[model samples]
Target: MKVSFTYDKKQVLQALRYHFLSRKEIRLMIILVNVFALGSAFLFYFKKILPLAFLVGSFLWFILMLSFWFFLPGMVYRRATTFKDHFIMTFDPDSFSVGNERGSRSYPWKAVSNFLETPHFFHLYFDSRSFFLVPKDSFSNSDEIYQMRHMLKEKIKN
Candidate 1:
């Protein structure tokens, strides 16, 4: 199966947020920070701790959320040249090829470590940090989307 695609800024940013949040460590950190912040609030309310503790905890939580929601996505948007170019991607039983004006690169299915599906894209991960963002809207129709999803499930472990 094959498809052509270009990234939309809003969609890509959302996908980046999904990518970050999908990581186990990041998710755990978010949960921990939220718990700390709420715990600080409770302590302050009960007069068991200084207001400064609550303020500091809330500030830290805010900073962490801001980095994930804005700073990180902004950095990725600026650094990613691939998002500006159009791409034609073909997926076969054994491998896949991605092409743009500059050139094309192909990789065997074994090269992919896993895949993650988000609302608007399929993140084809080469490793923990390296990945290709394939927009779901690139498919011609629902059938194409289903076929690609099926193919990825069969070809990649996760």
Candidate 2:
């Protein structure tokens, strides 16, 4: 099957956030920060910690969330020219190919280590840190999306 599409900024940004949060390290950090913030709040309420300590913890949590939710994704979207291009992608049992006016590249099923499905995109992950987003809206219908999803499950183990 084949589909052609361009990335929507809003959807792409959300997908990026999904990708970032899905990482083990990032999730761990977020959890740790949340624990700290909660602990700080409790301590402040009991007068065990100074107001300054609670404020610092709150500020740190806020900045971390802000960076992941906005700065990181926006920076990546702007820096990577791939998201701005129109693409045609083809999927088959043996391999998949993606191309634009500039050029095309084909890869065997083994190239993708795993895949993740979000509400708006399929993230084809080459490794822990790299991936390509295929917009779900580009598919002609729900059946095509289902076919693509099944094909991906068969070809890649996640």
For TM-score, the strongest prediction is 2
- TM-scores for all candidates: the values are 0.97, 0.99
Instruction: Name model 2 segments beyond 4 Å from true.
Output: none
Model 2: how far residue 62 lies from native, Å: 0.3
Candidate 2 residue pairs that clash: none
Q: Please give the RMSD of candidate 1 to the true structure.
A: 0.8
lDDT of each: 0.94, 0.96
Position 115, candidate 2: lDDT: 97
TM-score for predicted model 1 compared with the true structure: 0.97
lDDT, candidate 1, 1-158, per-residue tens:
88998899999999999999988999999999999999999999999999999999999999999999999998999998988999999998899999999999999999999998898999999999999999999998989888888999998986
> How many residue pairs collide in each prediction?
1, 0
**Poorest stretch of ten by lDDT in candidate 1:** 149-158
